[model samples]
Target: MNVYLAEFIGVAMLIFFGCGVLAGNSLKTSGSYGAGNVAINIAWGCTVAMVIFCLGDISGAHINPAITIMNAVMGTFEWSLVPGYILAQIAGGAFGGVLVYLQFIDHWEKTDDPHAKLTIFATAPAIRNNVANFFSEYIVTFGLAFCILGMGTNVFLEGLQPLATGCLIFLVGTSFGGVTGAALNPARDLGPRLAHFFLPIAGKGTSDFKYAWIPIVAPIMGATTSGLVHNALYKGIVDYRLFAMVGLTVVTFIAIKLASEDNKEAIKNKQALNQIA
Candidate 1:
């Protein structure tokens, strides 16, 4: 199997179970309806571990672009392969979304809330606070990257590494999933979002494209930062990329705050106009 194909399949399976579980909880009449956070988080972790177990030897079971990017930046993965790996992961995510859609075909209409349908395929901020959402995603993904990288330093038995990594995902989910669903991977959110945009799901709402950048940008920032920190700890070499990325992350946070304020102002103006009418 080609490495790209392996990545595609790996991520496809990852989303199949991860998103499928969410669909079960959100959609009506499913056995796991309203299964709640514990179920969702554990399902995500188990899906991740299963994919890594299956694809670990073939493609290193990245299944997440954040981890791939971290490896590349940390000098473990080739930069040239980065684009293909990411593309494969996204494609896999789309395919996985399709599977979940089919798995819950009957439930889409049974589910009346467009927001729930949208979250079935993508993530949304629980509180709609952009700055807080960014902080949540960034910090969770940062922990994900930092811990996964830290795992590489140890010599785990063959099956244990996948379990450890999966447990790490569960930890992140259980701890920080409330904010932005803990989207620690760009492909994890983007691929399914593209699926949501294109697929024929009844009464599905906007794909929330405007908010999509948070998942992609925050995770990349977190991953790069984690790589820099891990490198410092492991090799003690200060890479200039660390400073650049940190500066950029700061700028991004400020931009999010500005955009959020603009959105609030727009809502206020619209509300006042409604009062006049």
Candidate 2:
């Protein structure tokens, strides 16, 4: 099969299993409803690893437009193939979303929360502030790209690289996923979100297009920054410590901002409750 076809299949598998778990965990009446974050982290991590293990040799198992675009920008992958890879990944993601919706059709009617239904297909911020949400995606995606580049340099046993990479995803999701749902890929968000918009699910809410740009744009920016830094550092043309310091700074900033926002929100909630009383 062609590389494009392989990418489609690989990404389909990634989304099918990854978002499948999200659907299972969030949709009412599903056996795995409320299976919790650990389950989600593990399912996504394992899905990625399984896709890579099965299709890496065939298509390099990019399975993510952000990864594809980053590699292309970094000169590691061909520019000519970027469009095909991205398109395939998005289509595959949509395909996966449709499958999950069909699988959980009954649950959609049973569940009252539209956001929960949306979560099964795409991501949203826990606390919605544009700047903070954007930064949340950026920092985590930077970590993702940086770690992926680092993983490539390591001499792990042939097939073990995928497993290691999967673990890195799990680590990032657990550590940095609190604010923004850890969508490190544009296709992962966009394709499924489009599916959510068009799919005939019962009582599903607005697709939340207002906040959609953060995931798509921020991940690309983060991945590009990581690729440039990785390429420079790998060639000894730049200091690795510089990236470490920058990453630390960004994380610190995000933490402070999120904390401040949370406190403000808490005060507002309390004030509203007191007024009601």
Candidate 3:
């Protein structure tokens, strides 16, 4: 099979199991309804492993546009193939979302909340602050790409790469996934969100396109930053510039969180004042 085809199938499998888990957990009347975040984190990690184990040899099982873009920017993957890889992954994601919709058609009708139905197809912010959400995605994907780059080095065992990568994903989800549902991949979020927008799932509700760009843009920025630092560190230069870049990113992430909290507090105070008046 062609590399592009393998990427498509691999990512499609990723979406199939990943979103399928979401649908089962969120949609009413499903067996896994109310299963909670731990189940979701576990399922998503396992799905990543499954796809990589199956297609790793064919396409390195990127299964993520962020990974593909990072690899290309880092010069580990050919830039010429980046476009095709992204398109294939996006297509796969949409296909996976469609499959989930079909599987849970009855459940969609049973679930009256549009947000729940939409979440089965894509991610949304827990706090809904754009800057904070963007930084959350940026930091999460930075961690993802950074760890993935480390895992790809010669130190790790070759046969265990997929399992290691899956574990890394699980760690990310549990540790840093709260803000924006941890959408560390553009295709993983965007494609499914698009599916939710177009597909006629009864009362599917708005796709929340306003915040879609956070998942897409933030991941790319994070990936690019990680790739550059990883490559520089891999080359054994021990450059201080890498540290500066990382420190700046950390500070930015912290600032966003603090700012968002301040904004929420202000809103609450204003509400209280209005009530008193």
Candidate 4:
């Protein structure tokens, strides 16, 4: 299969399953309602794992710009191919988002909450603060990219590593994902956000373009930062586990600090309001 074709197929699967979870959850009377955070996280993680299994050999099954960019940075992929891959991935993701929307169109019209409709198509923060939302996406993507770098470097662990990487994403979503809905992939966010903008949906929130840059910029920054860190630590000796642990820990620490700061800010704001009232 052609690389672009593989990217299309992989990204289609990603958005289908990824947004499918939201449709399942947000649509009233659906079987997945109240299925809660664990389901969404596991579904996304498994979506990545499944896509990689189906298309890894064909196109490295990036289905994500961060992954493609990181691969290019590591010299695993040619720079010229990056744009095509990213375009295909976005197209596929948008296609998948449209499919999910169509599948749940009736439920969407049946509902009236704009936020609920938005959730069906794209991510939104639990609390709407730009700084917190940006940092959340930044940290999640950073951890994800760091893990990808560590796992992708191991020659003997090719097939199994994708599954492990998927689990890392799963954990990121479950533990720290609540703040910003864990949009760790740029294609995953932008493609679907675009779909929501174009698709006929009732009461969908604004596409939030001002905040849209977070997922794209942060993931690339996180991924590149990971690559730099890996190169710095690369001693011509391959120790996959050690590298993974160290890289994951560093990213996780950053994410936790961001989250903690956000919490502190929230508390301070509440206290200030109390004092005034």
Q: Residue 245, candidate 3: how far off, in angstroms? A: 8.9
- Model 1: residues with Cα > 4 Å off, grouped in runs: 273-277
Give per-residue CA lDDT, model 1, range 119-183, as digits (tens). 98888888878899888888888888889888889999869999998898898899888878889
lDDT of 2 at 54: 84
- Residues 26-61 of candidate 4: C-alpha lDDT, one tens digit per residue: 777677877888998899999998998899889988
Model 4, runs deviating above 4 Å: 153-159, 235-277
lDDT of 2 by residue, 1-277 (tens): 7999998888778778888998888877889989888888998899888988888889899888888888887778999999999999999988888888887777889988999889888899999877788888987898899999988887987688899988988898777766889999998998899999999999899999988888888887788778778878787645554466457657855765786689789999999999999
lDDT tens digits, residue span 1-277, model 3: 8999999898788888999988998887998899888888899999899888899989989988888987786667999999999999999999888888888878888888999888888889888786778878987898889888887675756668888888888889888766778989999999899889889999877999978888887898798788888877787644565566577667766776787789899999999999999
Ten contiguous residues with the weakest lDDT in model 3: 236-245
Candidate 3 vs 4: which has more TM-score: 3
- lDDT by candidate, in order shown: 0.90, 0.85, 0.85, 0.80
Ranking 2 against 4 by TM-score, winner: 2
Compared with the true structure, model 2 gives a TM-score of 0.85
Where is model 2 more than 4 Å wrong at Cα? 237-277
Pick the lDDT winner.
1
Error of 2 at 252 (Å): 19
TM-score of each candidate? 0.95, 0.85, 0.86, 0.81
